[model samples]
Target: MTLPSALLLAAVVATLWIAARSWTLPAFPGRTDFVLMQLSAAWWSTAVAIESIVPDPADKLLWAEMAWLGIVCTPSLWAFFLWSYTRGELPERWRLALVTIGLATWAVALTNDAHHLFYTAVRPVNAEPGAALVYSHGLLFYVVTIYIYAFMVMSIVVTASGIHRATPAYRTHYLGFLVVMAVPWAANAGYVFGNLTLFDLDPTAFSFLMMDGIFYWLITRRRLFDLLPVARDALLDAVPDPVLVLDGDGTVVEANPAAQALAGDHAAIGRRLADLPGLSALSTMVAAKPATVSGPLTLDCGGSPRCFEVTWVPLTAGGGGREVGCLLMLRDVTHRHRAEMRLEDTVRRLDLARLEAEERLVAEQEAKRALNGFLSMAAHEFKTPLAIIDGAAQLLLMDAEVKAPGMLPRLEKIRRAVRRQINILETCLADDRLSDPAFALRRDRLELPVLLRAAASAQGDAAPGRRIELELDGCPARMTGDGPMLELCVHNLLNNALKYSPAGTPVRLHAWSERGPDGQSHLAQSHLALSVADQGIGIPDSERERVFDRFFRASNTGTAAGSGVGLNMVRRIAALHGGTVTVDSRLGGGSVFTLRIPLCEEAPCEDRMAGMPAD
Candidate 1:
């Protein structure tokens, strides 16, 4: 075989073999453009091989024109593939424009009959048995040549710029790509300069076979196009997370600024994770041999304990068939960890406080129940004996004149004492009933003024020496409530006024009614007020609220002979009627206790003034 024919056959075989081998390797960065560039080189080789041996000059010219298709497209394809192999992505518009320009130049070269812009003239070979046809160039041919050279030069420049910045394995791969691209470029240069004239061969086609084998070896063995290096200065230093890259033997190969800061004063690169002072916890995690582990880990780092979320990621090669190294990333989680701990402590304390409060509440409720039982039992027990004594005194009073003159008066005093004792017992019993939650209001339509008058009369009868003046004037007669409860409430108030005042001092029991004094009405209910005013020792303002609490009496009451439940029962009775009892008093002046009930309807106005009666 002639030298040019032999080279062309070898070129075709090598290009085809590499294009096929590309499929077997795992998909990598530039596999698409690599396959296409190889295929185009193969096509060009086949056309060149046919053109070299063809007997007819016309057939050779046709094949030479066919071969131009690969010549025009191969460099641009290599340019794009190199860009994608080194950098990450190519802009779609740039890739498309490149392919369009390449195909346009190929079209011009093919349709040279119309324009003659690609080749000024085509001449047949001065044949030595296996000589290839050569063409004279036109303006467009040089333009296309320069265009092809620009693309190849750009591919070389892109690869060369990244070599120093690339990691060791990546630098070797980039150098290999540059060398393979340079083969065809140098061969074409030699041919153009008339330096490679052996047997009239186009050396560019011969160089394709050399390029194919180099690329195939680079891809399968070196993994040249698998991963590319990013701009380390921009990405690594600016990232907030600490990142460390280690080699196969666990030596730190790269450390970002964050990683350096985390490692303290010492440099981290070239040191093993086990040797790092601040990364003891991280070293232990790496030693555990887990494929991936991530969680909170604490490091003392020569100061207060710092917390980090540590991640262990093992780097792999050959689709995880080989272990390259591991990546140790640490992110500061101290603030988050402290906040979570504080929240946990707060929740724990609140839980303890809540349990204590619940226990106290249970104890208080038990004490209240015990007090109520004692009061109920005492009242019942006291009432039975008081009734018997009251009956005996009444019988003795009727027959006292028959015994002695002094015995009659003594029996009368005994009757009054028994009646007072009975009143006290009744007050205690009322307190016990009011304390019960099940005691519901049994409402009835009754004349409230009549109830108040009866209560005043009863009080005067109970304490004959203490005068109580009844004033039911201007009060609403009709009201809805439990008549007995309201009567008892009024009687308690009258008794309080009489007991607190001096003997012979007038205790004023007054009743009145009102429509809407304030807008604070529920369902537009009206109000009926019964006030007990005393010209006796008065209450202080501070003691008013507490006076209505169960078994609570004012401090100014001063050893008064009384059960404390009388006013409390009055307050409860008022609440049952959806009303309130309020007090007005001074230290020297006597006090007024007012029981105001909510009437179901607006009361009819009486033709009387609102002020109290004069002495």
Candidate 2:
């Protein structure tokens, strides 16, 4: 045997050895093993066919047998790889089909030797000095080449599609295998097509050898076959709760299939822990300390509310050194936590109920004491006024001089004082009348600015020494409401302003139509605003909020003689008219009290018929 024959025999032996190993290799030996085997077989067959066509008759039958074996094995190996990868299932029908195809191809090649169809003849050539070679081709030879090329393309497509369908975990393994498979297939096609001409340098055999190394490395290093058990164990372990391994920065470094099942079907790896519900707070807690906390947590998995007892512990080495990350174990504690919270709430409510009962008892006792004191004070006030009226009437009746003009004036003064005292008593007794449901409003229309002017006039007349001013900026339009009540609101505001302000300072009653942001004029048709401002000792900031409360008195008013009910009454009347009264005041800078009212159009006719004074 020549050197070529020896090399061919060695290549064929290597191909068979690698093929047998691939059947049970631990990891994907990649396409390199199959591709190398195919190339070796093809090389042997083509060499034998060429050698058979030569004039040399020695070993012609052996070369023909070798060529036939190569032809049969190449497609058989290619078909096995294609079937295993693409379909992911190996059925008896597919195996039988592959066997039948291989036998048919081998039989056709054998028949070509007798009938000169597959390969017509072989011609020996000495193109290069001291080199012997033969070239052979036939009709069936070209047809087989076409079939092989078509099958190679189909294999590439199927393998690539299968790789694409694989999970991300297995993608790298499959892709590496694809590269190993593709290289030799491409080299074989190049060789068959005469595109490659490297003497004694068989790319097919080299590719297979490279693929064998790849498969060995994959099996030893990647441990692809071990993944199934690991994945199964991970799923079984994660079935109880959401199990996750987080990096220091709060990213999900690893998660099992169960974690995915609980959280979401989306890829969780490398996603920021903060992005997941309930997990973000865990990150914060871990940063602070290793402790357990139970709370209500929401998860995006299904927007389900879960209660979790989150346990955080630092991962430590044998020497008590801190590891790079910490383990977070979450246990569903919703029912338990909720029950505890409900118990706490029940205790708090019971305590509050007990305290409220105590407060009510104390308040009842206080009310009794305050009623006793109020009655005594009321009796003393009533007795003094009654005694003065009695004494004045007795003096008038006892002396004829009491009937004189000076005596009558003193008598009138006594009468006025008694009336004032009676009014105070009436106000106190009728306080509950304000809350009466049947306290109907006597509505009417009156010019607001004119009424304001009249109230200012009356205030000035009552205190002639004080100067008052009226700054009526808008139309003196009529508004509907109870004229007397509206006038009383104006009067009380003016009185409070005068009583608090210094003498000789201007007391201004201002009315205006203002446009608001809603593009509606406040006093255009339905609403009116009137302001009574005083240049007096303004209310203190602390007391401003309570100024409208009944019996609320400011400390700095310096014993100004007036009931604190004026502003309260003003607020009540404004509210009755579907309006509100607000105060804008600063201490020592005087106060601006604004009354907003819903206008009544029919107030003028009613006021005129009732002989009521109009503004």
Candidate 3:
């Protein structure tokens, strides 16, 4: 055998060896392109071998083999180039179509030769010195040759363009494949142009064999066979749970069949880990440690809930090199986790029930103690008012100055003080009754502006000299609630505003009707937002949230007497009416307390307002 033939035989043998060996190795990068290129090169070598052996100048078998070889190798070469160019992103349909077309062409060519329609005869002869070979040319033979060259050129151009568009990581391998493909392509062009003949030197076939050798070297250097075998086995294997491995850069370097199955058939490999759903926490866990760690993870896999116990271990290169990637092993633990959670929930409920029983017992005892303390405080509060009444009455009876200039005013002050004290006691008793748990709202439709006016009038009567202004804008809207309870809430808010604000500051009470989002007619029915703004020393920022708690008061508002239950009562009443009370206040800058209530349901009006109540 000559040097070229010897090289061809070696290349063919190596191609078969790698194809067989690739089934066993762990799948790694660049393996599929390597395998496909090997097969194409092997077929090309078989054609070259046949051409060298056949002595006939116009041998039909020799021409048929060349045409069949071109048909088989052309698509395979294109596919390999595509895989190299795209880094394996070429769609499966494109590859299948190419292969199908090549095989159909081969079948037609083979049938034509068998029927003697394309080539008629064969003859053997010595052609030239040291170039003992056969050659053939016919109408169909030259036509197929032209088609093959044209197709190869087109495939190469497309492959080259795809290669240029590839990412930087795969560009080197694509460029190398391009050069290898270019050599055979250029050699064939030279032969066609008569610059070189098959008898003189088959440099194209020799160069092709060299390209195949270079491909083998590159493949073995990167252990590309490893990737092919892993991919094949993963497709064949059946594992229970999703499993994947990630490189140090957090790209999914490998995934098993089960992993792909769980990930919804999406391509898992060569994609960044962060791009995958429900994998962010796993990535974070692995990155934080960069060492072996195992824990439970809850994930929404698509729309279905899944739980996993994932173990992550760092992967190291050979010779004790630093860590390069992580090997993730996932085991489905959804059933186990749910079982454990159910048992824990059962125990927690039992504990909570027992704690609640204890709390109820303690609450009853505290209520009894509170009642006793309240009675003592009530007696003291009543004694002062009773003493003032007794003193005023005795003065009126004994003094002839009862009709003096300021005598009547002093007596009225005494009476007002007694009335205020009585009102406080009555309010406290009502509040206690409302807290009895059996209390529920006796809801009814009532005009909101009328309620506001009544509340403002009562506050003005209580604080005789304080100016309480009412700004009733638009028609009076109505709301559904216990009229007495709502009145109490409005009364308390206005009272607190007047008590806290400086005397002579205009206490503005406003009422209005407005629309809401729900398009229903809230006729005379709207958010009766009664805002009692005070130009008083407002509640401080730190104490704003606590102001609604019973008995809570701002320490900075010195000597300002209050029971501190007014705002708390307002909140409870708002909650009862399915509404809420909010305070916008600044220390030393006054406050606006808004009571938002849904309009009463049955109030008559000419036009119905359209909107939902503001909360």
Candidate 4:
């Protein structure tokens, strides 16, 4: 065989092998049609190659018939392949019809010799032995040629439509298919109409071999049949989060619909991220480090500031861990960011308020300590002078009584005045000591009537003109409590009663002990109530509750020479004994101050003030 013929035969063999291999590939859209089209191409190339080197006209005609059989089937198979490739599968009926038509055309061509329909006359073009045959016009040949031309036009339309619909990445593959298919059509047209011949053989077979090679190259190198572009489009385009595919240099290679909108109106492919206003910060981050996922990146998107969490995904080549590209995903986090800012602001305000309150509390406590120290020092100083006056008054009273019996009452008044002053000083000293929480109560069993008599006698001595009386009504004879504090509490009440009441009015001390509901209502318990009743100026309704507050003086105690701490101290002492003090008064009708203490259980005590100390 000649070298050219040998090469052509080898090409034909390779085409057949490729067609067989393509048919065995896993099924996908247009898979069967692709295999059928390739097989038709192989068949045509084989017959044409065989016809080229044959010597007999009859043998050439037989080979030409075989070649024509493949030729007639080629366009229909190609059309079906486009239908499946572009539109994802033809209807079953449409596929069947195309197959039937191709088979019928081949049958008609087989009997063409009887009627002179396919070829009117046939002869070799070179008039040399082992040269390819040439054909003259026949009716059947023209009819089949027109049918094939229609399919060719339809395949072109299908491929063009496919290219239009393809992604930017896959459009080149569809264009390659169109260009390869056109090569055979162009070769066929030149041989039939323009009389262009190559090496005394039809060039259509060579074009078919070239087209098959292109198909194999496109499928292998470009992965044209994998349909990954479709998958990439379906998943990435439909996602709401902005996604970007970047090359190793951080240039944007592909962007989805959301990313395009985020980047503003422009083409994104092949553009560097730094060129975009919203994504420039991301570009800077990626440039610094190949892969990093840090977020809450703020950007102005379409004139509105929004927060987004950015994720940087490294795209590696296969499993080799070689860095190839990157993927950026941005998720919106505006609401969460705003909420965090608000919470931080709220915490700042609360911290300021807490600090201010702490400062105020510290100042108040310091002032109270200063006031308590002043009271303690002043009471101690007054006691010294008060003791001297009381001793001098007693000595004068005795000397006056002995030397002049007529001056006895007047000197006795001087002694009572000194005693009253001493009593007031003692009250201040007791109040200072009671301010200390660690000061223990002095508990003892003492009769309420006896304490009441003693308090009345002291007040009667202080105010000689005032009538003092003791009224005892079923009062307990004895109870356990702090005797000195109780005596001070009663003495203060008696002083107020005698001091405020008119000189001739009666000041009554009423005492009672009874089984009744404790003020706190803890079952029935024994109680002793010591009341100091006087017909004096009374407390008003408004200041009733505040009468027991420290340093609170009644409004209507007109020009009354008294310290305001009396009632407050009384209330404190009563509370220390698990008791309470209250008042019932009317304007101009006078007031009754009552101290009720719960009685303690019977116990033997050697000392009168067992639980209390004099200090």
RMSD of each: 10.0, 16.5, 16.4, 10.5
What does candidate 3's lDDT look like per residue over 78-189, in tens digits?
4445444334445567656656656775676666656654455544444453344334445665765676676566657755765655434345655776777787778777
Per-residue lDDT of 28 in model 4 = 54
Which model, 2 or 3, shows the larger lDDT? 3
Clashing residue pairs found in predicted model 4: 442-482, 442-611, 442-612, 443-481, 444-481, 447-477, 475-513
Q: Order of candidates by lDDT, top first?
A: 4, 1, 3, 2
Task: Count clashing pairs, candidate 3.
Answer: 15
Q: Give the best candidate by TM-score.
A: 1
Q: Write the per-residue lDDT of candidate 4 for residues 28-94, one digit (tens) a residue.
A: 5676777777777777777877776677899878777777767877778878877776666777787
Q: Which stretches of candidate 3 lie over 4 Å from their true place?
A: 1-4, 22-37, 54-67, 70-72, 75-77, 80-136, 167-169, 195-201, 219-615
Off by over 4 Å in 1: 1-4, 20-31, 55-58, 91-94, 111-127, 132-136, 164-169, 197-200, 222-332, 356-451, 457-488, 491-571, 575-615
Cα lDDT tens digits for candidate 1, 227-267:
21333545666789998877666677677878877789877
Q: Return the TM-score for each candidate structure.
A: 0.60, 0.36, 0.40, 0.50
Report how far residue 542 has shifted in candidate 2, in Å.
74
Cα displacement (angstroms), candidate 4, residue 267, comes to: 9.4
Task: Report lDDT (CA) for all predictions.
Answer: 0.74, 0.61, 0.65, 0.77
Tens-digit lDDT track for model 2 on 525-562? 44577888887888899999888888888979776786
Worst 10 residues of 2 by lDDT: 606-615
What overall lDDT, based on C-alpha atoms, would model 2 receive against the true structure? 0.61
